[model samples]
Target: MDIKPLLLASGMIAATALAGCSTVGGSVYTASYASITDAGYKLPAIPVSKVPEQYRRQIVSYETKEKPGTVIVDTTSKFLYFVMPEGKAMRYGIGVGKEGFEWSGTARVAMKREWPVWTPPAPMIRRRPELAVYRGGMQPGLQNPLGARALYLYKGGRDTGYRLHGTPEWWSIGKAMSSGCIRLLNQDIMDLYDRVEVGAKVIVK
Candidate 1:
């Protein structure tokens, strides 16, 4: 009956029920999500028990007409799928735009960066003045919102100012919390950064 749809509509209940729905072997998930040393920072390992099974990265049967290497972000479901051959995909949990910031559209990965600098957009700075200090851009580091990797999104060669990036706030997954960009676990994003190339298609829905 697709109860997950209804559960997702109720955040509190969904958190409990979804956590009980499915699970993975500790060894496998633990290994895949182990701490990483990137650009001189030690990314901590994820606490597998705190991550719901549905949100963990895994391969699943995905029926999509999109070609392999395409990226699809289902914001409502907090999932990002990387399409693969044979109607399959590597799905990762994501944090989407919160409230008024929600957005949807198709774009192309215009660029990819590791430990990228972060500069809050003008509007965002106007809303949160403290970010104004970063008008010149925040240096990349563990505390950077872009985390370990970032894939800049553009449409028709115009920068959309959106990105598929990593976040240190791992607990934000499966929730709507970002300003507009899609965020994944640092571990997951580092892995994805290696797989996706600049110019790949990205569909946000």
Candidate 2:
């Protein structure tokens, strides 16, 4: 059986998604990421070929002392690992904060939300006055910075003002971007949102 047609179709899907010239449906990487509607918001397919394979979500033999249900963010490597039982982890590529904006600490998933509203922090607005227009909170939608899901972080019962959230900029994964949030692709974050519970331990390193 000739497989050239299958390979060519996969290539076209990636190209169309990358060029943003067409709606992308299933081809390759469909099991991991395909365009979908979540909470009435349509998320475009991610051209996962443009992202390194290691950054794609996969279950790996990750040895860690952290108990299951803990989230470990490896800042240097741009990876987020959700600890599972039996010395394994569900690892996903992530985008972290830039230079001075990097944060490292233990926190809890204080809250979880679907299609979360985004309000620029006061300090952020101070830096970019144009965002003052959103001081009242930006309504949730596809264009929202928080994307399809957000896991708010807190420590010692106080809001840490950081979040593990989804981002529309899937290309930014495996890189240092964002102000301080840990951002993942829409599909990855949606998977995480369902797996992670509020009060899950999060260690950012």
Candidate 3:
């Protein structure tokens, strides 16, 4: 007539089930931490702390027809998912373009750079004449708008004039800012830059 053993077994089963659900739903998470020293300036590793919990990098269970290694960006949600096998993805928070600068299309990563120089396109300078000083090109440094890395996007062997790049402005994640290019926290973009290869598929929608 002892019921304690049965109750204990049921509790164990329930706990196990909860753990599995958490893993499948991609609720368990951790933040990235790394010291970034570049261009004579050491950037303190605080991006993880600055970001919201929902925007932190984590493995997520994503349902998509796209193949693994593909980068799918959901601007509406300000999330970028790097597709993986078994319906999983490494998702990160992103800063998308504002209303008029928004763009959606498929492209491939044509190039990758570390501490890339920033050249304000003529049009961009025209919009803000103060940027004229950098008209030739801004040297790569911590203060450069491109931040620590850049992934140039191209379509059909043509430059899209858009990029998936890093920003020192970690606070901008999960917002509609930027001219048109997709932006990520410096630490997050560094992680993404390592995983993504040139010629990888990218879908922004």
Candidate 4:
């Protein structure tokens, strides 16, 4: 056997594995660039090409009894789905709460806001004094933790202190890193914000 042939085979195998690591599915590639907007405040427009293929917004075959317009969050899989008729859904990747902060329940979107303000809760401020500066509420802008939009969650007519909101940290789209809120990429959340209504149902599991 020629040693050169064996060396070429090994190189080919290594190259195949490296390429697979960068892809979410067969023939689908992640996005490479994004656009930014400066309408009053700087806002980012995430390119569909920059987002991973699986995370990009798409209509998918989903089985659920929930009516169209309902939002379902599957924390384990890091996906959020907006149910539609005919067994379909608009699915987007999400960033969920960290280990001990995870929650599951039914709630309703009680309010919606664009470029929402963020106020560090008392407990959170106590845990990290640096957050105390935002106790009165941080102004809405690119650096705001709430990003470009927010849908406030409520249960039994009371605020749950949980939210479905956008994040400036686009890289966190498929991770478990939020305090307790359900987070989406800024562009995705902006799209979701337009479709979801104040009285729409939300299921988190």
Candidate 5:
């Protein structure tokens, strides 16, 4: 079977739904996410020991219908819930679209990448040509724009150009930022990525 058509459909659905809707303060600080070469970029040193051991442990919330293999990003609460079976969800802090980019809808995980590359869209480059430097792709690591992982969103089966990925700017959590992508802490994203498989259902609300 031809998967291209199916993939495209899913991408479109994901894009349409996952696109952000709520903006925090109607202020977009572009400089906060200015471009930086991967070589020069680094994740702020964090004391893993200091990171609450409980938070590191998967959280099972009875209120959520999430299963062990699914992903849900609740922008309202600034939480990303990875559903574990028996009405449990592993929740993580998230940074959503600031304002104009905020969106709430349902989607699916069409694909995923580890240490994915960064390719700012043409418009993004147009708005800030400095992004033109990393057109094709970048290496995955502390410097990579996609952080530690990227869970590509889809609707019926098409590319929405939206993603749930990690960011070096851990402080950005709970804020509306990014061109339109859902950003999460590197460690948190890595953990979620490991638990989700391709084609997993994603609900963004």
Candidate 6:
């Protein structure tokens, strides 16, 4: 089977939804085209009770300050820390950038979106023409590139366009992967999203 047609079909679905009349939808459809919604896509839920008991507390260690409400991600260790003030951190497993995209820096959460529209950067589209379907912003939905939720980053008040977000691909955790975003499991990100607000400090190193 030729992979090109398969990829092209996926691109068409993404492109069509993005180009469709922009309006909020009342019903949720699991079909790929039905992914986008009014507020944003509702990320699929995986009951925490069902999560493997063994995987619940997967810890990647680092000695960062435990300042209340601050979040830290150590790419080297694939750990995300939610500072808990009393010299302890609540850590979660994460997926970092694919080798060449790995970066270290400090930034702040400039904004947060429940489900964000995604527009491929010129380089990203150039690298994958299939992404050209989204020359305009992709609609917010399960199919959207930003995934379940997006925490936009900023440095000195400028949009960095990089995000810390969730992915449907749960297996990607702890692995290095393409692009400049940080990927978390949907369950983990939903937990983190509930705890963070705009203006939170984010340290990625």
Expressed as tens digits, the lDDT of each residue in 100-132 for candidate 6 is 888878889988887777888889889999989
Off by over 4 Å in 6: 1-63
**Clash count per candidate:** 0, 0, 0, 2, 30, 1
For residues 64-164, write the lDDT of model 1, one tens digit per residue: 98999999999988999999888777889999999999999899999999999999999999999999999999999988999999999999999998999
Tens-digit per-residue lDDT, 145-201, candidate 3: 998899999999999999999888888999998999999888888889999999999
Every model's TM-score: 0.85, 0.85, 0.83, 0.81, 0.71, 0.71
Q: What is the lDDT of every predicted structure here?
A: 0.86, 0.88, 0.85, 0.83, 0.70, 0.70
Residue pairs in steric clash, candidate 2? Answer: none
Model 2 lDDT per residue over 1-205, tens place: 9999999979978875654331123222233577898777789988877988778887777889999999999999999999999877788899999988999999999899999999999999999999999999999988899999999999999998999999999889988979999999988999999999898999999
Any residue pairs clashing in model 4, and if so which? 31-49, 31-50
TM-score of 5: 0.71
Instruction: For model 1, give the 10-residue run with minimal summed lDDT.
Output: 22-31
Superposed by TM-score, candidate 1 places the C-alpha of residue 142 at a distance from the truth, in angstroms, of 0.8
Write the candidate numbers in order of decreasing TM-score: 2, 1, 3, 4, 6, 5
Comparing candidate 2 with candidate 6, which one achieves the higher lDDT? 2
For every candidate, C-alpha RMSD to the true structure in Å: 10.1, 6.6, 6.9, 9.3, 16.8, 15.8
At residue 171, give the lDDT of candidate 1: 92
Off by over 4 Å in 2: 1-31
Candidate number with greatest lDDT: 2
Deviation in angstroms for 92 in model 6? 1.5
lDDT of 6 at 54: 27
C-alpha lDDT of candidate 3 relative to the true structure = 0.85
The regions of model 4 sitting more than 4 angstroms off are: 1-39, 47-50
Candidate number with the higher lDDT (1 or 3) = 1
